[model samples]
Target: MPYDLKHVFASLPQMERGQSKVISGDPKGNNFLYTNGKCVIIRNIENPQIADVYTEHVHPVQVAKYAPSGFYIASGDSTGKVRIWDTTQKEHILKFEYQPLSGKVMDISWTEDSKRLAVVGDGREKFASVFLWDTGSSVGELTGHSKHINSVDIRQKRPYRIATASDDTTAGFFEGPPFKFKFTIREHNQFINCVRFSPDGTHFATAGADGQIFLYDGTKGELVRALGGEKAHSGGIYSISWSPDSSQLISASGDRTVKLWDVGSGSAVTTFSMGSGVNDQQLGCLWQNDHLLSVSLSGNINYLDKNQPTKPLRVIKGHTKSIHCLTVHKGDGRSYIYSGSSDGNITRWDSDLGLTECFSGKGHTNQVSSMCVNESEELVTCSMDDTVRFTATGGQEYSGDVVKMDSQPKSVSASGALTLAVCIGQIVLLKDKRKVFSSDSLDFEPEVGALQPGGAVAAVGDAEGKIHLYSVHGSSLAPEGPLLEARGKLTALGFSPDGAFLAALDDQKVLTVFTVADNYSVKGHFYGHHAKPVTLCWSPDSEHIATGGMDMNVIVWDVNDEDKRIKMPDCHRLHHVSGLAWIDAHTLVTTSHDSTVKQWTLTY
Candidate 1:
């Protein structure tokens, strides 16, 4: 068996209502990066499909910047901790870690030599810190702004200089080897949001909430001119990205537009409207080679085409929220992974090719609680919106029949054409989206369920840590025998591929396996998971089982050998595993709240 990672489907940059999310592109113009939870995601500039995630941070990361040399990356988190790591290797080994501020570290900048770093953020005493990259030795002070700093950048040329944007409506400039505060420019009537030096270090620009872009000489920090003659953007400017030649720049704004500006001419060359919705507001921008990119408040990354200003060249879309459920459906010799996030968005991923295509029509309005592939090769999903939706296995739109669930659905399972959904107060059984049997007044509260592959048996777990077996009668279920009880409240349950065994997990952190052939007799009680395991799938050979838990660990248990198991600890950093599915007996896919889906090869 081969259990190593093959590919990662990275999450979209995390977005908030008013916060400006910072995105940085590498100097080499090959990759761009942003933060989602504790990880910094780096993806190819041209092919956004190829990505890598740095998960060494223990706190929620705010920003990540690639070194000028493109060999190292410095990322900062909510706790004001900055971690410098190697980007050339797969492990991303830690090079250095420093606590730059007492509060959140909002931004980081590296000098052209990559020998020094300046970090700025909200802190109790000082809002910024400047130190040597090799050692934490202090090199200078950033003390002009009274309020917390929002952005910072270091000049790339010889006469080293640093600039900072602040909530105080001012832009501060400094010169360094041992950086020292030079002067503060208070031309903006509103808060300054971003500042950046040109690639050639000949000039620098600052954009602010006042809707203005002020250009200045890089060496002397003298105000050169302001773009647009009036204001750069109609709404507050949030970010600016300088072109490689330092001759032009682009700014993203809350006005739902991105503008390309000629620095030397001080004129707007082109303007692109993102969309009218509030979520379409441009929050971040990047200029890499011929590709100009902007991040909308909705978390979609847009590729701006200078020749066609009205329409984007392409739009990269994915979930920006925590994923909660996932399942794998294999058909036509290809495996498709379906994932549902907390926001009700559903995406289908190709396991072998590492590709994704989101559904086209309107689907769930709220979080999708559970999903399974039914016998007729349709995806059956239940959600918090009080409805069930079905999508064709290979189609891009909803096939039209939407089943209105009687109550809040907690879990769902399907076997061929038969499906069983456990609602908060009801258990509804359906065939092809048509409700066949439903009972809202069960004696025990149904928590989770699993339907046998042959659609002959059903296992319903309740809050009392009991697994109730039922025989599939024409359209209804009949109790089979004594309940299989465990030590804690049952959380999840599944039947083995061969229909010979059944597995149930409870809050007590115990996984109890029972033999279906022996009147549901105890088969094994595995107890290695330190936390409640919510996701489980059996191998094709039915000899091994993989479980993912709230402890951020993925454990593969050997059924025949009680002492043998493989554990992958901290599988997705601070996020818990949302679900798991087997691509093959030797391959497994795990999705998590981190908004990432990972493919792992099992080695035996």
Candidate 2:
């Protein structure tokens, strides 16, 4: 037998309201990097779904910057520590570590030669530092600001220079091999949020919370001209990126707009309205190659189309928050994976190429608790928002058919055209979003629901450790057979693809399998988990069952031989597996609160 991890679909940039987020692109314009929690995500710019994550830092990471040479990456965290690691290998071995400041390191920059580095953030004694990249020795002092430094940049030419933007509303300039503060530009009436140098190294720009943009001579550290004269955006500018040719620039703002400007004319060339919602506010952006990318406060990344000013070519959507539920659908000769996050956003991904697209229209306003694919190739989802919705598989949008529940929906399962959902204390059956049947009354607290294959029988698990068997009528479920008892509260339930057996996971760390034809009696009990199992899926051929638990482990059990089990431990380090699905007979996909999704391949 052979089993190993295959690929990883990394999470989006962690976004927060009223906070500034930074996105950095490699020199070759191949990949982009951003910080999320304690991890730094690196994704292919061409195909955002192809990603890699570095999770070495213990503290929440604030910023990451790519070295000029594009071989090493340096990331800074809230603990004021910076770790430099090699990017050429999959392991990303750490090369060196340094304590740059005393508090959160908010921004980082690298010299053109990749020999020196600058970091700025909140520090008890000093707000920023400049050091030799490899030696971790002090190169110069970054002082002058009376408050936290929010941004930093380094000139890439012969006469290297440094600049910093601070909450004190001053933009400072420095010059040196051993850099030292030269002067302060007090042109802004509000805090400066971003400072960047043009690719040509001839000019630099500063964007401020006051909605103003000031251009300066990069080499002389003198004022050149103010772009847009009085202001560049209606709202505070969060970030700015220079075009490769150094002739134009793009700015992201809190006004929910992204604008392209001609640096020479100091006029806006085009303005792209992201949206009207508060989450539409632009937070960060990047100008690399032919792509002009911008990040909204919602964590959605937009690829702006200069030709079509009103609409972007694409909007990369995913959860910056934890994901709880997901399901796979295969139809029209294509495979799609739909995942719902804690924030209620749903994303559909092409299982083959990893291309992701977000659903449009109104969606769940809270966490989605369970999801399953139905006979029509549509997705049925239950949410904590007390609603169950039907979404089309190919259209990637809600079908406008929703059922409001009396209580929060806990779990949902579907077989053919029959759908069954377990709510707080009742079991409901629906067909095409219309209620077909409802349980008269319940004596047990239903925790989960499952529908046997071929749409014949429905099973409901209760907190009392009893599995209630139900015979599927046209639209309702009728009580049938005796109660299947468990050792603890039933947390999860699933049926084998062939509908010959049912599997139940309880709080007591035991998994009980029962034969469907044997009046749902216990066929066997598979046990070995150290903690409560939260999710389970069956192998395509019904020969194996995979389960992920609170112990941070995933186990592949051969149903015929309980002793033959494969345990993949510490799947997400410190996070529990929140959901699981089978991509194929030989592949398994797992997601965790850690904001990462891993795909594993098995050969037996």
Model 1 over residues 1-604: C-alpha lDDT tens digits? 3368887888999997667789998878899999988889999988888999888888899999999899999999998899999999989999999998998998899989998999999999799999998898999998988899999999998889999999999989998778888889888999898999999999999999989999999999999999998889999999999998899999999999999999989999999989888989998999999989999998989999888888999888778888888888988888988999989898888887666778876788899888988877888899999887778987888768788887898888888878888898788888867899997768998999999989998889999988888888989988888878977898888888898889888888888888888988888889888888888888888888888889999989998777888888877876888788887888888889989998888887
List per-prediction Cα lDDT, in the order shown: 0.89, 0.88
| lDDT minimum window of 10 residues, candidate 2 | 1-10
Candidate 2 to truth, TM? 0.94
Scored against the true structure, residue 138 in model 2 reaches a CA lDDT of: 93
Per-residue lDDT of 122-225 in model 2, one digit per residue for the tens? 98979999999889999989889999999999998979999999999999999997999899989999989999999999999999899999999999978888
User: What is every candidate's alpha-carbon RMSD to the true fold?
Assistant: 2.3, 2.2
Candidate 1 — which residues are off by over 4 angstroms?
A: 331-333, 398-400, 559-564
Candidate 2 global lDDT: 0.88
Q: After superposition, how far is residue 13 of candidate 2 from its true place, in Å?
A: 1.7
Q: For candidate 1, list the clashing residue pairs, or say none.
A: 1-602, 1-603, 1-604, 2-601, 2-602, 2-603, 3-601, 3-602, 3-603, 375-416
